[model samples]
Target: MINGDFNGDGNLDIVVANEDDGYLAILLGNGNGTFTGPFYSAPIFSYQISIYAADFNADNVLDLAIASSDTYTLVISLGSGNGNFEDPTFLSPENYYSANFAIGNFDTDTIL
Candidate 1:
């Protein structure tokens, strides 16, 4: 699971990878110790393991990077800044050691 202010609402929201179901579920925070949702992403048909949240497109909105072990793939879900995400964009890593990754401005060039 991962948590952040996904909707720019200043409240912490959550994202969970459903390993058994091959999808990601989001829970939007209400800021009063409560949350709502379980908003789902499209199925990946693989065993999901790790998830990373960041603004991958430099859009200032938090986005998602989901890793699946069973299929050896990584998927991107761009956020709409309103607790909603676009469809997943699938990627195949040639020699990934595990179903996990880190997000950062690896090149130190103001982008990720």
Candidate 2:
């Protein structure tokens, strides 16, 4: 998990992706400073990707970026205020997949 907070709220969220399952899960940031995930399961028909966490939408709530060998996709889930996240997949750009991904606001728009 990138920016792993370990409690999953909305202020310290983390981003994690798997390639074989093509699954990208976000760990929400709890205001108290912790991240929680396991929000989704690995799909049966896909490759796992490397994921990174950041607030791509600049919503203050953390967003996720899943990196594939072909591209990097964004999944910004809405926070339930309880460390739970739901669908909000936003495709970003073509990025090469690596065993690990870097997290941060490389564009100075969010956090890692």
Candidate 3:
């Protein structure tokens, strides 16, 4: 699971990578410690193991980057400002597995 203010709602929300179901589930928070969701993403054939949240596109909206082991790919799902995501952009590594990810200005270019 990963947590962030994905909708810019000032409340902590959660995104769970469900490998068993081959989907991602989003749970939006109400700020009072309550949540609402299970809003799912399209099926992915790999086992999603880690999730990171950041503004990957520099669009100011939080996006999700998921690492999957089976496909050895990093899938980026851009947020739509309403706790929803667009179709994922798939990136495959030369290696055969990806288990984790981190976001930052790794190149000192002010981008992640």
Please report the candidate that would top lDDT against the real structure: 3
State the displacement of the C-alpha of residue 50, model 2, in Å, after optimal TM-score superposition.
Answer: 3.3
lDDT of 3 by residue, 36-95 (tens): 976888876458888888898989999988888877888889998789999998886667
- Looking at model 3, the pairs that clash are none
Where does candidate 2 stray beyond 4 Å?
Answer: 6-15, 24-37, 41-45, 70-81, 88-112
Candidate 2: global Cα-lDDT?
A: 0.49
Local error of candidate 1 at residue 78 (angstroms): 0.5
lDDT agreement with native, every candidate = 0.85, 0.49, 0.85
Off by over 4 Å in 1: 94-98
Model 3 misplacement above 4 A: none
TM-score of 3: 0.91
Collision count of model 3 = 0
Q: What TM-score against the true fold does each predicted structure earn?
A: 0.89, 0.45, 0.91
lDDT of 1 by residue, 3-110 (tens): 998889999999888888887788999999999988887776568878888899999999988887787788898999998889888776655644878888889999
Better of 1 and 3 by lDDT: 3
